[model samples]
Target: MKNSSFIRKDIFGVPVLKSEILESFKDLSHGFSTRRGGESPAPYDSLNIGIAVGDLEENVKKNRNLISGISCSERSVYLTQVHGSEILVIKNDSSIPDPDTVKADGVITDCKDLALVIQTADCQAALLYDPVKKVAGAVHSGWRGNVFDILGRTVRKMAEVFDSDPSDIRASIGPSLGPCCAEFINFRTELPEALWAYGDEKCFFDFWEISRAQLQKAGLQADRISVSGLCTKCDKDSFFSYRGSKITGRMAGFICINN
Candidate 1:
């Protein structure tokens, strides 16, 4: 299923997953990183792109640099994702700041060569690109993000800031916790009533469908949206799953307008 929408490639020894939908655009460069081939040791084994996940800052920095190199990004913005509705809009190089100080779950930019990066272990990293407006966005949408509708907010942000029409945007939902492994036993107390309907008889929720619904609600065309259908928790050898291992490393999903 992953091969249908994505391609696996080795970049500087790191395994990166690319979306064929995004790859069709010659002006963009994007990929999702796997958890192998980096400088970090166990728990983080290698390629842990997250700095706040208790990994050594130096190792994380190297891993980040490696991913940037793999993506051909002149500059990469790694947000301190809070699973909130806030979406940072970058219109020019002047608007760029130290991303370490910026806290947001999603980021959009029209500037070329500036890669929008979202680090995740099991959360969905939704990458959106509007060829009409030449704008790109990356959002970190976990369960809390779903509650806040962060993806919808991101699409709105792109529209309000970059004049991007949701219909003209092509979006892709990357590898995350699939419904088969996403069991929420406490759904009665944790999730909202509306969200409970998306769960199965066993309390397993389909977050991928939830993301698609949110995107459609934001006015995106159904045909333009792509889902990787790769489950992180099920395929532990290829991805990092927070639910599977509490002390595991994090993978990265990146998108950039080529310079």
Candidate 2:
């Protein structure tokens, strides 16, 4: 897959979504936001998207609305990422009513007018779309989830649930902590044995490569997948990096079926 760089500013004064790849989806409103435009205070600074991180509820709600205005539905389904392999199939009614409701790593939905949302700081946030089926999915793939091959599983689930063909699916790997900053102390124990079992004994792990590999393993066409090779830790001004700040805000990676 080839990576193209793009940037867009939201009406709310924050950098929301990338521009170069937006041309591919004419029927969807999607964006991967930065921590720049919001009403929250320090720690959460401005555009903090996570509600459970102690940011005021009102502020979080407002932030959500601002981002949603760009490319989401009136009702959006947000996942409670637990760093696991559980992928839930969401319907129109399965939204996150409160911040502490349900927990899952990935979500897939075929219902129109219902957007799929995922939150992340340093973890990988992937958006999958089947233009032929008009179905979209959002996945939060952390190191733990990657070890379990959550992306590959999510692709398979999308195929089973929406009758989507991997060849017809277009995906984007949003900003995440890259190998330059993602250093593991104990490579053998920190990562899955299976990763090392395949002879990846390097000091640092490249999540972008791992994710791209997983997408191909799921039978997705190489040209259909795109990655935003921006490293969260490397670009702190435009994104929030968990490794950069132990206590920091989250960015929203959103995808929706246009009404």
Candidate 3:
């Protein structure tokens, strides 16, 4: 959701999704990518960033180059994204492959030399930063992730690995399927009853609110959390929604600290 509501910018040509909440952090390079400004053909139409989603690998490489360039990255780390809670921690001395073969849904780093990337079509990409500890984390969270408390776990991982206190952490929930179109036909078996309260008569779930709740449980202040509030399904022109197109491109949510 790189609309006006988000900290929108045209980087060379791509519409980048940024968080105004994290904008004040002068030493961080973090933003989400929209569906525009790429070389991939229709279905992926312009800004498809995912390498395994049927798009031309060469085209994805070009888009990836643009993304890394925006952050002025020396190295970029991408996750395999299994929709699970596993997280990868990157140290300053870590040597990652070019295409990023790590298999995890969340990534955390205290090093400023590498940028962490998470690709998403409709799932929420939750970016976290602890200014006090100078640490950053990025999560690939969807309904399945929520069911396992992935956001909270990522926060805890930051604390365990980076010595970060959740109370001092600031969060940004990026564009994904909003409550308006987050319908789950078998939510009763998919989600807990407590979360069922967020469902509408039509079965739409308030994932943003759910993210907020998860943040609270992890100890972040309510005011410290920022929500993009942009629905990818509705804003199909600027975003990629898996449910909207079934075979659409993925938006990139990237975060990195500055040296």
User: Which candidate has the top score in TM-score?
Assistant: 1
Question: How displaced is residue 107 in candidate 2, in Å?
Answer: 0.9
Give per-residue lDDT, candidate 3, residue 11.
Answer: 78
- Alpha-carbon deviation at 151 in model 3, angstroms: 0.4
Show where candidate 2 strays beyond 4 Å. Answer: 1-3, 19-22, 92-99, 197-202
Candidate 3 clashing pairs, residues 3+ apart or interchain: 38-46
Best by the lDDT measure? 1
Comparing 1 with 3 on lDDT, the higher-scoring candidate is 1
TM-score of 3: 0.95
CA lDDT, every prediction?
A: 0.90, 0.80, 0.87
By descending TM-score, how would the candidates be arranged? 1, 3, 2
- Model 3 residue 182 CA deviation in Å: 0.5
Question: RMSD in angstroms, all models?
Answer: 1.2, 2.8, 1.7
lDDT (10s digit) by residue, model 1, range 86-132: 88888885678788788899999999999999999899999999999
| Model 3 lDDT on a 0 to 1 scale | 0.87
Q: Which stretches of candidate 3 lie over 4 Å from their true place?
A: 1-5, 97-101
Model 2: per-residue lDDT, tens digit, 113-191?
7777889999999998888887788899988878989999999998998889998888887889887877776868778
